[model samples]
Target: MTAGLLAPPTLIRTTRGRAVVLGLAAVTMAVEMASLVVGRSIHIGSQPLSASVLPGLVLLAALGAPSVGRAGDRDRLVPFWIAMAAGLLLGVALLSRTGDLADLLGLVVAAANEEIVYRFAVPVVLATALMVLRVPTRAARVAGYVAAGAWWVLLPGHQAQTDGAVAMVTYASFAVISTVVVARSRALIPMSIAHCVLNVITIAHLRGDITSGGRGALSACLLFLLVGTFAWPGDRPGRRAAATDDGDQDLVTDTVIDLRDGQRPSVHRGEDLTWVDEPSEDDQPEPVGAPGDRRSANHGPPRH
Candidate 1:
């Protein structure tokens, strides 16, 4: 598997994808720093860093959720949702030491900002560009993951202490999981909730006392789960469904509706389109060609 993955096309595409996503993430980071500076001056707060950073994270997630979610929709949403709910309950009980609920308040802002910045905006933009540039999926996935983690590390005090470090790790871990889950599920809602739940847990933990060793173990477990989930056969979402002569597993991508919630599906470049061409009043039917037309014969039979 390793040798095959290192073939020429794969190597070149992976390298290119890494570079593209890295470059985009670097630029986005610069913009975020500038925005933080601007936002700080215009605001009043003792914890200005938190104030500045949380909103940035939220906006990034919001911007990217649709596309990322679409990519992840095929996965088992049940496990993802269960993980979130359980994580949330544990987080509230163990992490939120202040018990004031306000300590968790910063979390709301953080979730919004981080999801957009790390999960949605950065991944979608970078991944799309890399894929367009013919970057290999493996490389694109790695680059996007690293870029998101880098964004977390660069946060104001993300690296300053053991606690901050722990929080950053779990928080970033959440993003990583959400990305995979989102791509696998090919639907955004569950992953978005998962992302939010992860943040809420981190915030709660910040207020409580969790041993470093325990944190490390938990991180390891989550990371393991992420890898395991992605490795499962056809259980994940991707640039397209399983490729075959028949294309039996193909999904209609052009206009995926968010059936999980009432929200309309956001469009992405390469999703299945069979779902979109359904007979809606707004759709314009293709013209039937002349009797001798080869085009009609080649248009092929409509997929079920």
Candidate 2:
């Protein structure tokens, strides 16, 4: 059991694994819909748990499942740390103002639950299904991301209850951005932290901790700036270097194979794919005689 838990995500390559992922996705949607019909949150003391059991399970499965393509290559933690700092600030601000431990706990749990469902599980399963069906990688990924965002926007009862067009648009945009970030990075850690921060800000605003729209707007801008800066591409130097090395190695291997198979190997040196030809023995220059011997022979001939 311990070995299985630690095993690589090779199972996701199998048809069975794909089926399982898809099944989990279906179950997650069903449970979320049911939760909407019933109560969205279950209160246990001051902390309320979002009814996201299936979605949470799906996240756990994704953690263990093997993914196709470059899923493993994109897990950067720096952005998550930045987001965590922002979340801590939000939490601190809320606690300082309200002194309500229940609200704080509820915000944390809600944020985590929402991210696990909409950002991690739903997208992973949808993308995995698309990949199994041999969809183009980028298209599949984009489709999965859009699907997750749509799920959040269309299915949630709270979102439906939100008043005004501006508020709805703002909420949708926030969900979409969070989904895109998680999809592109293929890591939930950063998104979870970011979501927590957003939730705290939202709850605080709703609770009147933030008196005006201006302060809320400022907080939102700062949060976006922090997450965006840290999550920007090439931010993790080590991961970028590793990806570059892997790509270079793959290119070299492909070139070698093509050469061995008597095919013209087009090597991408810089921007151009230039064909390289193997040098033959006849192409090599012949050895020349030493200067002293050549001079002596020439002088003797001149004398004769």
Candidate number of the best lDDT = 2
Show model 2 residue runs off by greater than 4 Å. Answer: 1-3, 6-27, 37-40, 44-48, 54-83, 89-99, 130-134, 233-304
**In model 2, which residue pairs have backbone atoms overlapping below 3 Å?**
9-66
Q: Where does model 1 exceed 4 Å of error?
A: 1-31, 37-76, 94-99, 123-149, 162-210, 220-239, 242-304
TM-score of 2: 0.59
Please give the CA lDDT of all the candidate structures: 0.44, 0.54
* Shift of residue 119 alpha carbon in model 1, Å: 2.7
Q: What is the lDDT of residue 183 in candidate 1?
A: 46
The C-alpha TM-scores of every prediction are: 0.46, 0.59
Candidate 2 lDDT, tens digit per residue, 1-304? 1222234253233344334544555567567667877866686436666567546645445445211122323443455356567667777776766566566666666666677677655665666566556554446556876887887877555566678888788778877666545543334544555666776766667777776685578567755653454344544564346446432111111112222332333356454443444435675334444544444534543332
User: lDDT tens digits, residues 220-304, model 1?
Assistant: 5554444444334354444345422212121111111111121222224443233221345555345666556556567776555
Model 1 lDDT, full chain set: 0.44
